[model samples]
Every structure is written in structure tokens, then in C-alpha cells.
Target: MNPLFRFICACLFTLMVLAVAAPGQAQGDGWPVSIGSPAPDFRLPTLAGQSKSLSQYRGKIVLVNFWASWCPYCRDEMPSMDRLLKSFPKGDLVILAVNVEKRIPEKYRKAPVSFDFLSDASGQVQQRYGANRLPDTFIIDRKGVIRERVTGGIEWDAARVVSYLKSL
Candidate 1:
């Protein structure tokens, strides 16, 4: 390769890599998605052989949870999520319960449960929602703005979160 051409190619490659890594450069804390940024869209398969998309749940308040069966906190939070889903006063609240456990096809499919159970065996969905910790919850308001993000375990039906959802 010619020297000038090689230099140009090197610069271009460096710029591309920098662009891909730019999102992380300024962020030093825990939250992955910014408060005002549009919630990242994802399409993953549900345990019941259905596909779930974040974009499809627009026009409603969405509670996006990242959890695993092995995590005790995650296990504890399931009931709250279920209750929240069933008992929420209005039809505008939706829960997208995502499981980050390994894809155990039969067990996931056969398990009888309430609420939508989607898979993120590769953890891509989890990372997108800033669910680095088990049982992380993100509340995306009706306007598709990510309003709140709670790390670790949380009561999805808690009054504070509920009030915010209601306001949306």
C-alpha cells in the first residue's frame, strides 16, 4: 500500500472506532441510558414463542426489568412485578419482564407463569436498559422518554414509581 493511502486508511479506522466508543467516554456513573434519550429499542423472543419489541409498547408506560432465575433478588421481585401488572389501575402500564438466564428452551416454554417472559441469553437487552445488576428496573414514560432507572432490586408496585407512572 502507498504511504499516503495507508495513512488515510489508518485515520479513518481510528475515527470509526472512536465513534463507536464515544457513548461511554463521558459517562462515569452507573446509568446506561440517559434520562431524556429515547429508550433503546429491542426485539427478543418470548418464552412462549412470541417476539417482544420495545417499540411496540409505545403509547404506554413501560416497566422494563432485567432479571435472572438464579438471582435471589430477582426471584423476590417477580411477585411484585406480577402484582403490578395485574393490579395497575389503568391499561397504559406494561411490563416487559426480561430473563437473562441461559436459554433452557423447554423449561422456559413449559413454565406456567403470568406476564410476558422474554429471553436475553446474550444479555444484549439487559445492557441496553442499563441492567448491569440483577433486578434492575427502567421506567419509560408514555412519551418514550426514560424517566427513571433503579439498580438492584425494587418494588415495581411501590407508590412512588406508581405515582410517576400515573402522572405519565
Candidate 2:
């Protein structure tokens, strides 16, 4: 084997190892709150102008989603989230859709959202939750410990997701 070829192969192998390990090791960088971490609490005004806080939802499984109207994935997964919210009884689960956009879009205003639609106009709440990406979701257990952190869009009403939430 050629010396340069062997060196290239070794570099490629090392890169592959890093890529595989990145998700677990990069948790602090990409996901500020890891599984089992205590979720940060914050209070923000909902679309109805009511002040809401994470602590207020204690004893209930909460799904805190950070989103923006301009994000296509955020908009796409909203209906599924609403459906997911409906599947569970009112007191069984709480879904807080925190909009990070400064201005509320006309479509969102007109949309029939069953969950609590909170407005993070200044992005303070989103920042506290370390939601740097749009459509980030944190599933907090009844005790207020974050059980899961999902970044990006997903089918909120999917059977698997529903089962997991139910188990929590």
C-alpha cells in the first residue's frame, strides 16, 4: 500500500469515529439540556395574554416546543402537534408552543390551535431553554425533569411518540 494512501485512510477513519461520537459528546453544544437534566423554567405571555410559567405546569407531562412562523418545518409540524394535544385528555398533558417570532403571522392567528400558544416576542424564553434551532422540543416529565430533547421537526402525533409520552 502507498504511504499517502495509508495516511488518507487513517484520516478518514478518524473522521468517521468523530462523526459517530459527536451526537453524544456534542450534547452540551447543540443541546444545552440533556436527558435527565432539570429543565429551565420561564414565564411568558400566551396568545390569550395570560402569563404562563413552566412551574405552573408541574405534575403534568409537558411538551415545550420552540417555533417560529417563518420556519417551514415548524409550520408543518404544528397541525400534528395540535392533533397530539387532542389525543390526550386535557389534564394528562400540556403542550406549550412558544413562538419566537416578533410578529404573529396571519395564518397562525387564524389557525385552530388546541394547545397553549405562547408568544416569545423577545426570544427570552427560547434563549433560556437553549432553543437555538427552530422546532426544538423538550418533553418534561411530571417532576419537571427533561426526559427527551428533539431538535428539528417530527410527527408529534406519531404512534411511537404518543406511546412514549403516554408511558411517561
Candidate 3:
């Protein structure tokens, strides 16, 4: 066999092996929640000792953020989310910050925000949403359909982002 042909065959074999090993490599973050899917309904206890469900906000745009208090990015993006909350009229939008951990961090004890911070003690809600990574966000329309799935941190109050939400 020609040496060049052997090298080409080896490379092809390696490529084939990689493709089979990681079938989901093409997906940016392997988020199971595909865009346009119905947002999974979940009831989680709020920081205020109340329970909230995604279905309750069916007539409003909902931003379901999966985050942990210790995650710096989650903390950083939260303020912008507050600003985003203020942009629209009352009841137009609902921001649900679902904390994956069991305990609410002390830092949030006094932090003022318009959004609701809920606790996912059992992590069942996180698993249901496939939020394995911190700072994952799902933008659900008024009809409860997930319009977007964001994998990482972003300026939630950016003009373009707000405009996009407004359009929805």
C-alpha cells in the first residue's frame, strides 16, 4: 500500500471515530431544550416562601433563568435582568430566577429586584429543563412556547435583547 494512501486512511478512521464518539458535538452546549419547544411547566418554592408555576404566567412573556447564587456570571447578569424587568409595563413580563442549590445565598437577602427568585432544592426542575450549566436561560412566549435557549451569560437589558423581547 502507498504510504500517502495509508496516512489518508488513518485520518479518515480518526474522523469517523470522533463523529461516532460525540454525536452531539455540533450542538453548541448540548442543551436538550430545543428552540420552539413548549417550556416545561414546573412549580418551585420562591425565596419568599411561596410557590410559583410557569403556567401561571401563560399570558405573559417569561424569562426562566437557571442559575446559582455562587455563579459570578449569574450574579452579574441579574441586575441587567432587573433592568429588563422595569422596561416593560407591569405584568407584561415575568422573570423566574431558578436557583439550583438548596440554600438561598445571604447576598440575596437584601438585594432588591422585581423578578422572582425561586429555589430548586431537589434540582428536579433543573434536570427537567436540562440546565446542567449555570446561567442557562429560556425565553418563553406568551403561549408558553420556548422561543430561545441561551447557554451562557448575556446583557439581559441590552437594547437589542429588550427589543427582541418586545417584538415577542
Please report, in order, the local distance difference test score of every candidate based on alpha carbons.
Answer: 0.78, 0.87, 0.88
lDDT of 2 by residue, 1-168 (tens): 999999999999999998888667543454456678778788888777799999999999999999888899998998999899899988889998899989777667667888878889998778767799889999999999999989999998999999999999
**Per-residue alpha-carbon lDDT of model 1 for 1-168, expressed as tens digits?**
899999999999999997887677543333467776778888989876789898998998888888777788977877777777776755678888788888644654655445788888988777656677877878898878888887787786798766767788
How many clashing residue pairs appear in each of the predictions shown? Answer: 0, 0, 0
Give all TM-scores, in the order shown. Answer: 0.74, 0.78, 0.80
Cα error of candidate 1 at position 157, Å: 2.1
Looking at model 1, which ten-residue stretch has the lowest summed lDDT?
Answer: 23-32
- Model 3 misplaced stretches (Cα beyond 4 Å): 1-31
Following a full C-alpha superposition, what root-mean-square deviation does model 1 have from the true structure? 7.4
lDDT of 3 by residue, 50-145 (tens): 999999999999999999888899988998999999999999999999998889887786778988889998988788778988899999999999
**By the TM-score metric, which is better: model 2 or model 3?**
3
- How many backbone collisions does model 2 have? 0
* Deviation in Å, model 3, residue 32 alpha carbon: 3.7
- Model 3 scores worst on lDDT over the 10 consecutive residues at 23-32
Number of the candidate with higher lDDT, 1 or 2: 2
Q: Relative to the unseen true structure, what is the C-alpha lDDT of residue 134 in candidate 3, on a scale of 0 to 100?
A: 85
